[model samples]
Target: MNPLTVLRDSLYFFQRNLSQIVTLCLPLVIVEAILQRIVDDAVGPDASAGFGLIVGLLVYPLYTAALILFLDARSRGESPRNRELLAQAVNLWPRFALLSAISTLLIVLGLSMFFIPGIFLTVVLAFSEYRLVLRGEAPLAAMKSSFNLSRGHFWRIFVCILAVLGPLMLLKEFSYSLFSKDDNTLLSLVLDSANSFLQLFVSVVLFRLFMLISDKSDQ
Candidate 1:
């Protein structure tokens, strides 16, 4: 699919299952909020807090993959129990966690050299969780698969992600500009909350895209 069409379909899918999506993501949202607060308190306005926050943000993708796996199974007319889904997800956690750590390290290392490589790594690994969840691949294999899947489609996927993510980011910036206090902490919190919600939404959309891409590839 073209970028715009992918975005349109993703948004439509999200809206169609909004209630179920929200219900699945609520726990992750709460956990993200708490982690944000903790990271903020621990780092206290330092630049390193951004890195810590990014590390914490990895949790959402893992949870999102689990949710998408469960939802997709149901969508395909499979009778998947929530507990069974959660167990399967948890079983994969160690591998996922290791891959996430490696990915984060690579991104950070690349960014330390310059920023471009970091962005490249981010795009390449974008489909790792989806690959792992959907195809039952090992973490490194999934990462490699995601990289290959995204190779020729880099710009397309990048544009699609930005289309969904850019507006939410702009809104957060505007809110902070309008309502930021002298202290900045409250504004930071508000922006973080907005970002968390947007990330959750994007995760769901991306999962749908992964499914679509996989189907097309199969055909």
Candidate 2:
């Protein structure tokens, strides 16, 4: 699994299906950002950061599951409507939410332990969402499976993630420097939504890698 090939293909897919993806996920992403902003405003600057995570948990699973299902459908050459995909995602919400929460907690915990472990955890747990959503595994089981699945392919996955996210992180910093959220709430919201939406491309690349690894593992 060459990281460049994975990135190139994922970029192509992202560009090709940009319209459908925006229709399917952008509203939810904007909603999440708006809710987060509301929470921030209510709690003031001293607000607990975890409040944002709580808001995310409420809506993240919905759109993320829908996006994943859409990715699967497109890969299989089936054209699924957004509403239908959303309904299926809603049905899968409970499991997906649980999985996401667990993953986030573990990643956060790892980050607290000097940061390197966090990066390691992120890489190894990359495919847990795919395992859970695509194969119906329980949250913990999916995480464990991802750990095993990512064994030899860790560098490829890690490099691919960094390649995609590195520039985005810089863009985020640059945006913040130009417009303080407190002073320009609307612009902040727009930037936040756009950044979050672009991050979905990481999911696309990871899905590609997941299929490749799964195929090899099965064979």
Leading candidate by lDDT: 2
Off by over 4 Å in 2: none
Winning model by TM-score: 2
User: The CA-based lDDT of model 1 is what?
Assistant: 0.71
- The digit string of per-residue lDDT tens for model 2 on 34-53 reads 99988888898798768887
* Candidate models: Cα lDDT each: 0.71, 0.93
The residue-by-residue lDDT of candidate 1 on 72-143, one tens digit each, is 775687756556666676777777777777787888888887788987887788888777777888888989
At residue 144, give the lDDT of candidate 2. Answer: 97
Query: Clashing residue pairs, candidate 2?
Result: none
As for candidate 1, its clashing pairs are none
Report the Cα lDDT for residue 158, model 2.
95
Q: lDDT of model 2 at residue 192? A: 95
Q: Distance (Å) between predicted and true CA of 147, model 2?
A: 0.8
| TM-scores for every candidate against the unseen true structure | 0.82, 0.98
